[model samples]
Target: MQKKYVTIASFTAALEPGILEETERYLAIIILLAGFKRYRSWRVPIAIYGSALLFGLSHLGNVGWNGETFEATIAQVIGVMGSGFLWAVLYLYSGKLWIPMIFHFLMDYLANLQSGWNSAGWQFNGWATDYISEVLMVLVPLIVTIWMMYGKRREVLEENADRLMNLPVEFNRY
Candidate 1:
Protein backbone atom coordinates (compact mmCIF):
# COMPACT_ATOMS: atom_id res chain seq x y z
CA MET A 1 0.00 0.00 0.00
CA GLN A 2 1.16 3.50 -0.74
CA LYS A 3 1.86 5.74 2.18
CA LYS A 4 -0.89 8.31 2.62
CA TYR A 5 1.51 11.14 3.26
CA VAL A 6 3.58 10.33 0.19
CA THR A 7 0.53 10.06 -1.99
CA ILE A 8 -0.88 13.32 -0.75
CA ALA A 9 2.42 15.06 -1.18
CA SER A 10 2.87 13.71 -4.66
CA PHE A 11 -0.61 14.78 -5.68
CA THR A 12 -0.04 18.19 -4.19
CA ALA A 13 3.25 18.54 -6.00
CA ALA A 14 1.48 17.97 -9.26
CA LEU A 15 -0.79 20.94 -8.66
CA GLU A 16 1.86 23.08 -7.04
CA PRO A 17 2.49 26.61 -8.23
CA GLY A 18 6.03 25.54 -9.05
CA ILE A 19 4.65 23.65 -12.04
CA LEU A 20 3.95 26.96 -13.74
CA GLU A 21 7.19 28.50 -12.60
CA GLU A 22 8.94 27.37 -15.71
CA THR A 23 6.35 29.04 -17.88
CA GLU A 24 6.91 32.26 -15.99
CA ARG A 25 10.65 31.98 -16.31
CA TYR A 26 10.46 31.16 -19.98
CA LEU A 27 8.04 33.99 -20.59
CA ALA A 28 10.50 36.38 -18.99
CA ILE A 29 13.24 35.07 -21.25
CA ILE A 30 10.99 35.34 -24.28
CA ILE A 31 10.10 38.89 -23.37
CA LEU A 32 13.75 39.74 -22.91
CA LEU A 33 14.66 38.17 -26.22
CA ALA A 34 11.56 38.86 -28.29
CA GLY A 35 9.75 41.69 -26.47
CA PHE A 36 6.01 41.89 -25.66
CA LYS A 37 5.12 42.85 -29.22
CA ARG A 38 6.25 39.45 -30.45
CA TYR A 39 5.26 37.59 -27.26
CA ARG A 40 1.71 36.61 -28.21
CA SER A 41 2.29 36.13 -31.90
CA TRP A 42 5.63 34.30 -32.05
CA ARG A 43 6.79 33.56 -28.52
CA VAL A 44 3.78 31.79 -27.06
CA PRO A 45 4.36 28.42 -28.68
CA ILE A 46 8.07 28.65 -28.22
CA ALA A 47 7.62 29.39 -24.54
CA ILE A 48 5.10 26.59 -24.19
CA TYR A 49 7.26 23.91 -25.76
CA GLY A 50 10.49 25.23 -24.36
CA SER A 51 9.15 25.35 -20.83
CA ALA A 52 7.65 21.87 -21.17
CA LEU A 53 10.97 20.45 -22.25
CA LEU A 54 12.70 22.20 -19.42
CA PHE A 55 10.11 21.01 -16.94
CA GLY A 56 10.60 17.45 -18.16
CA LEU A 57 14.36 17.70 -17.96
CA SER A 58 14.20 19.19 -14.50
CA HIS A 59 12.63 15.97 -13.27
CA LEU A 60 15.68 14.07 -14.35
CA GLY A 61 16.87 14.77 -10.86
CA ASN A 62 14.30 12.23 -9.84
CA VAL A 63 16.92 9.65 -10.64
CA GLY A 64 18.84 10.78 -7.63
CA TRP A 65 15.72 11.54 -5.73
CA ASN A 66 14.36 8.03 -6.27
CA GLY A 67 17.72 6.25 -6.36
CA GLU A 68 17.00 4.84 -9.82
CA THR A 69 19.62 3.87 -12.34
CA PHE A 70 20.47 6.11 -15.24
CA GLU A 71 18.63 3.95 -17.79
CA ALA A 72 15.43 3.98 -15.80
CA THR A 73 15.77 7.71 -15.35
CA ILE A 74 15.95 8.14 -19.09
CA ALA A 75 12.76 6.20 -19.57
CA GLN A 76 10.98 8.16 -16.89
CA VAL A 77 12.25 11.41 -18.35
CA ILE A 78 10.59 10.62 -21.65
CA GLY A 79 7.29 10.06 -19.88
CA VAL A 80 7.74 13.21 -17.85
CA MET A 81 8.32 15.25 -21.00
CA GLY A 82 5.07 13.97 -22.44
CA SER A 83 3.19 14.81 -19.28
CA GLY A 84 4.67 18.28 -19.21
CA PHE A 85 3.72 18.90 -22.80
CA LEU A 86 0.21 17.61 -22.28
CA TRP A 87 -0.31 19.87 -19.29
CA ALA A 88 1.16 22.88 -21.04
CA VAL A 89 -1.02 22.32 -24.07
CA LEU A 90 -4.06 21.99 -21.87
CA TYR A 91 -3.24 25.30 -20.21
CA LEU A 92 -2.74 26.94 -23.57
CA TYR A 93 -5.91 25.51 -25.10
CA SER A 94 -8.21 26.18 -22.20
CA GLY A 95 -6.57 29.43 -21.11
CA LYS A 96 -7.17 28.24 -17.57
CA LEU A 97 -4.52 27.20 -15.09
CA TRP A 98 -6.96 25.09 -13.12
CA ILE A 99 -7.53 22.70 -15.97
CA PRO A 100 -3.91 21.73 -16.14
CA MET A 101 -3.60 21.75 -12.38
CA ILE A 102 -6.31 19.13 -12.01
CA PHE A 103 -4.80 16.98 -14.71
CA HIS A 104 -1.37 17.29 -13.19
CA PHE A 105 -2.70 16.26 -9.81
CA LEU A 106 -4.33 13.17 -11.26
CA MET A 107 -1.18 12.23 -13.14
CA ASP A 108 1.02 12.63 -10.10
CA TYR A 109 -1.42 10.69 -7.98
CA LEU A 110 -1.38 7.82 -10.44
CA ALA A 111 2.36 7.94 -10.77
CA ASN A 112 2.90 7.85 -7.06
CA LEU A 113 0.50 4.93 -6.68
CA GLN A 114 2.40 3.02 -9.30
CA SER A 115 5.97 3.91 -8.46
CA GLY A 116 5.80 4.61 -4.76
CA TRP A 117 8.43 6.76 -3.13
CA ASN A 118 12.00 5.75 -4.04
CA SER A 119 10.72 2.68 -5.83
CA ALA A 120 11.30 3.65 -9.41
CA GLY A 121 13.17 0.53 -10.53
CA TRP A 122 11.30 -1.87 -8.28
CA GLN A 123 7.98 -0.69 -9.66
CA PHE A 124 8.47 -2.80 -12.77
CA ASN A 125 9.86 -6.29 -13.09
CA GLY A 126 10.72 -6.46 -16.74
CA TRP A 127 13.13 -3.73 -17.64
CA ALA A 128 12.53 -3.84 -21.38
CA THR A 129 8.76 -3.80 -21.05
CA ASP A 130 8.92 -0.98 -18.54
CA TYR A 131 11.08 1.06 -20.86
CA ILE A 132 8.71 0.50 -23.76
CA SER A 133 5.72 1.48 -21.66
CA GLU A 134 7.46 4.60 -20.46
CA VAL A 135 8.32 5.63 -23.99
CA LEU A 136 4.76 5.07 -25.13
CA MET A 137 3.44 7.08 -22.22
CA VAL A 138 5.40 10.02 -23.55
CA LEU A 139 4.89 9.43 -27.26
CA VAL A 140 1.13 8.97 -27.36
CA PRO A 141 0.26 12.23 -25.64
CA LEU A 142 3.05 14.10 -27.39
CA ILE A 143 1.92 13.06 -30.86
CA VAL A 144 -1.71 13.94 -30.19
CA THR A 145 -0.75 17.24 -28.56
CA ILE A 146 1.44 18.23 -31.49
CA TRP A 147 -1.33 17.48 -33.95
CA MET A 148 -3.90 19.48 -32.01
CA MET A 149 -1.53 22.34 -31.33
CA TYR A 150 -0.52 22.59 -34.98
CA GLY A 151 -4.08 23.20 -36.12
CA LYS A 152 -4.74 25.72 -33.35
CA ARG A 153 -1.47 27.49 -34.01
CA ARG A 154 -2.29 27.86 -37.68
CA GLU A 155 -5.67 29.30 -36.87
CA VAL A 156 -4.17 31.82 -34.49
CA LEU A 157 -1.55 32.86 -37.01
CA GLU A 158 -4.10 33.29 -39.78
CA GLU A 159 -6.33 35.35 -37.52
CA ASN A 160 -3.43 37.50 -36.48
CA ALA A 161 -2.35 38.02 -40.08
CA ASP A 162 -5.82 39.10 -41.14
CA ARG A 163 -6.11 41.49 -38.22
CA LEU A 164 -2.72 43.00 -38.93
CA MET A 165 -3.44 43.40 -42.64
CA ASN A 166 -6.76 45.06 -41.99
CA LEU A 167 -5.37 47.57 -39.50
CA PRO A 168 -5.63 51.29 -40.33
CA VAL A 169 -2.43 52.91 -41.57
CA GLU A 170 -2.46 55.29 -38.62
CA PHE A 171 -2.29 52.29 -36.27
CA ASN A 172 1.32 51.86 -37.30
CA ARG A 173 2.22 55.18 -35.69
CA TYR A 174 2.62 53.42 -32.36
Candidate 2:
Protein backbone atom coordinates (compact mmCIF):
# COMPACT_ATOMS: atom_id res chain seq x y z
CA MET A 1 0.00 0.00 0.00
CA GLN A 2 1.04 3.57 -0.65
CA LYS A 3 0.60 4.48 2.98
CA LYS A 4 2.70 1.54 4.11
CA TYR A 5 5.49 2.44 1.74
CA VAL A 6 5.32 6.00 2.89
CA THR A 7 5.37 4.86 6.48
CA ILE A 8 8.49 2.81 5.81
CA ALA A 9 10.11 5.63 3.91
CA SER A 10 9.31 8.15 6.61
CA PHE A 11 10.69 6.09 9.46
CA THR A 12 13.73 5.13 7.42
CA ALA A 13 14.84 8.78 7.50
CA ALA A 14 15.24 8.89 11.31
CA LEU A 15 14.78 12.64 11.91
CA GLU A 16 12.64 12.47 14.99
CA PRO A 17 14.04 12.75 18.50
CA GLY A 18 13.01 10.24 21.16
CA ILE A 19 9.65 11.78 22.19
CA LEU A 20 7.86 9.22 20.03
CA GLU A 21 4.53 9.03 21.88
CA GLU A 22 4.04 12.79 21.87
CA THR A 23 4.95 12.89 18.20
CA GLU A 24 2.31 10.31 17.31
CA ARG A 25 -0.45 12.31 19.01
CA TYR A 26 0.52 15.44 17.12
CA LEU A 27 0.43 13.50 13.86
CA ALA A 28 -3.04 12.16 14.68
CA ILE A 29 -4.32 15.70 14.95
CA ILE A 30 -3.09 16.42 11.45
CA ILE A 31 -4.83 13.38 9.98
CA LEU A 32 -7.98 14.28 11.89
CA LEU A 33 -7.84 17.74 10.39
CA ALA A 34 -7.10 16.29 6.96
CA GLY A 35 -10.27 14.21 7.33
CA PHE A 36 -8.44 10.89 7.25
CA LYS A 37 -9.50 10.14 10.80
CA ARG A 38 -11.17 6.96 9.61
CA TYR A 39 -7.73 5.29 9.43
CA ARG A 40 -7.37 6.12 13.08
CA SER A 41 -10.05 3.58 13.92
CA TRP A 42 -9.48 -0.17 14.27
CA ARG A 43 -6.75 0.16 11.68
CA VAL A 44 -4.29 1.09 14.40
CA PRO A 45 -4.79 -2.07 16.42
CA ILE A 46 -4.95 -4.28 13.34
CA ALA A 47 -1.73 -3.04 11.79
CA ILE A 48 0.16 -3.27 15.05
CA TYR A 49 -1.17 -6.70 15.94
CA GLY A 50 -0.47 -8.02 12.49
CA SER A 51 3.06 -6.69 12.40
CA ALA A 52 3.82 -8.06 15.85
CA LEU A 53 2.40 -11.47 15.05
CA LEU A 54 4.50 -11.75 11.93
CA PHE A 55 7.58 -10.58 13.76
CA GLY A 56 7.10 -13.20 16.45
CA LEU A 57 6.48 -15.95 13.92
CA SER A 58 9.64 -15.02 12.09
CA HIS A 59 11.57 -15.57 15.29
CA LEU A 60 10.00 -18.96 15.87
CA GLY A 61 12.06 -20.64 13.18
CA ASN A 62 15.24 -19.33 14.72
CA VAL A 63 14.50 -20.52 18.25
CA GLY A 64 16.74 -23.58 18.21
CA TRP A 65 19.69 -21.99 16.43
CA ASN A 66 19.43 -18.80 18.44
CA GLY A 67 19.35 -20.99 21.56
CA GLU A 68 16.56 -19.01 23.11
CA THR A 69 14.74 -20.72 25.97
CA PHE A 70 10.99 -21.28 25.67
CA GLU A 71 10.25 -18.67 28.29
CA ALA A 72 12.58 -16.17 26.64
CA THR A 73 10.94 -16.76 23.29
CA ILE A 74 7.47 -16.15 24.68
CA ALA A 75 8.54 -13.02 26.47
CA GLN A 76 10.34 -11.70 23.41
CA VAL A 77 7.34 -12.42 21.22
CA ILE A 78 5.05 -10.62 23.61
CA GLY A 79 7.38 -7.66 23.75
CA VAL A 80 7.45 -7.48 19.99
CA MET A 81 3.66 -7.70 19.94
CA GLY A 82 3.44 -4.82 22.37
CA SER A 83 5.73 -2.87 20.09
CA GLY A 84 3.07 -3.29 17.42
CA PHE A 85 0.46 -1.66 19.63
CA LEU A 86 2.82 1.12 20.59
CA TRP A 87 3.66 1.80 16.96
CA ALA A 88 -0.01 1.82 15.99
CA VAL A 89 -0.76 4.34 18.70
CA LEU A 90 2.23 6.31 17.54
CA TYR A 91 0.90 6.28 13.99
CA LEU A 92 -2.63 7.17 15.08
CA TYR A 93 -1.76 9.97 17.48
CA SER A 94 0.98 11.54 15.38
CA GLY A 95 -1.12 11.41 12.22
CA LYS A 96 2.22 10.73 10.62
CA LEU A 97 3.01 7.09 10.15
CA TRP A 98 6.41 8.12 8.83
CA ILE A 99 8.11 8.27 12.20
CA PRO A 100 6.77 4.94 13.33
CA MET A 101 7.53 3.53 9.92
CA ILE A 102 11.07 4.83 10.02
CA PHE A 103 11.37 3.72 13.60
CA HIS A 104 10.15 0.33 12.56
CA PHE A 105 12.57 0.33 9.69
CA LEU A 106 15.42 1.15 12.02
CA MET A 107 14.39 -1.67 14.29
CA ASP A 108 14.22 -4.15 11.44
CA TYR A 109 17.29 -2.73 9.81
CA LEU A 110 19.33 -3.01 12.94
CA ALA A 111 18.12 -6.49 13.52
CA ASN A 112 19.21 -7.41 10.02
CA LEU A 113 22.55 -5.71 10.50
CA GLN A 114 23.35 -7.96 13.38
CA SER A 115 25.82 -10.76 12.59
CA GLY A 116 23.22 -13.49 12.43
CA TRP A 117 20.63 -11.63 10.33
CA ASN A 118 21.98 -12.58 6.90
CA SER A 119 21.96 -16.25 7.82
CA ALA A 120 18.21 -15.91 8.18
CA GLY A 121 18.23 -14.91 4.46
CA TRP A 122 14.53 -14.07 4.12
CA GLN A 123 14.89 -10.66 5.76
CA PHE A 124 18.16 -9.04 4.86
CA ASN A 125 19.28 -5.53 3.95
CA GLY A 126 21.90 -5.44 1.23
CA TRP A 127 22.15 -1.66 0.95
CA ALA A 128 22.29 -0.81 4.61
CA THR A 129 25.89 -1.77 5.25
CA ASP A 130 26.86 0.24 8.29
CA TYR A 131 25.06 1.66 11.27
CA ILE A 132 25.53 5.18 9.92
CA SER A 133 24.01 4.42 6.53
CA GLU A 134 21.14 2.58 8.11
CA VAL A 135 20.53 5.47 10.46
CA LEU A 136 20.55 7.95 7.59
CA MET A 137 18.14 5.77 5.69
CA VAL A 138 15.79 5.84 8.63
CA LEU A 139 16.07 9.62 9.06
CA VAL A 140 15.11 10.46 5.48
CA PRO A 141 11.56 9.21 5.63
CA LEU A 142 10.88 10.74 9.02
CA ILE A 143 11.75 14.19 7.67
CA VAL A 144 9.79 13.85 4.45
CA THR A 145 6.69 12.48 6.18
CA ILE A 146 6.64 15.32 8.65
CA TRP A 147 7.28 17.89 5.95
CA MET A 148 4.46 16.57 3.78
CA MET A 149 1.98 16.67 6.63
CA TYR A 150 3.37 19.87 8.14
CA GLY A 151 0.39 22.15 7.77
CA LYS A 152 -2.93 22.33 5.97
CA ARG A 153 -5.54 25.02 5.76
CA ARG A 154 -9.30 24.93 6.20
CA GLU A 155 -11.76 27.67 5.14
CA VAL A 156 -13.42 28.37 8.46
CA LEU A 157 -16.23 30.93 8.61
CA GLU A 158 -15.32 33.01 11.62
CA GLU A 159 -18.57 34.98 11.92
CA ASN A 160 -22.15 34.32 10.84
CA ALA A 161 -23.45 36.97 8.45
CA ASP A 162 -27.01 36.80 9.87
CA ARG A 163 -25.81 37.43 13.41
CA LEU A 164 -23.81 40.46 12.30
CA MET A 165 -26.72 41.94 10.36
CA ASN A 166 -29.26 41.55 13.22
CA LEU A 167 -27.87 44.13 15.62
CA PRO A 168 -30.72 46.12 17.26
CA VAL A 169 -30.79 49.40 19.18
CA GLU A 170 -33.35 50.88 21.62
CA PHE A 171 -33.79 54.48 22.82
CA ASN A 172 -33.18 54.80 26.58
CA ARG A 173 -36.06 56.35 28.63
CA TYR A 174 -34.75 59.38 30.62
**lDDT of candidates 1 onward, in order:** 0.55, 0.39
lDDT of 1 by residue, 99-138 (tens): 7666666665565665554324424445688878887888
For candidate 1, list the clashing residue pairs, or say none. Answer: none
lDDT of 1 at 104: 65
lDDT for model 2 comes to 0.39
Worst 10 residues of 2 by lDDT: 153-162
For residues 46-144, could you state the per-residue lDDT of candidate 2 as single tens digits?
333444455445445545444555544544444444454455445544545566667765665455444323212232233434334434443453344
Provide the TM-score for each candidate, comma-separated: 0.63, 0.33
The lowest-lDDT stretch of 10 consecutive residues in candidate 1 is: 165-174
TM-score of 2: 0.33
lDDT measured at residue 144 in model 2 versus the true structure, 0 to 100: 43
- Model 1 alpha-carbon drift over 4 Å, by segment: 1-42, 118-126, 152-174
Model 1 — TM-score against the truth?
0.63
Deviating ranges (above 4 Å) for candidate 2: 1-43, 95-97, 105-174
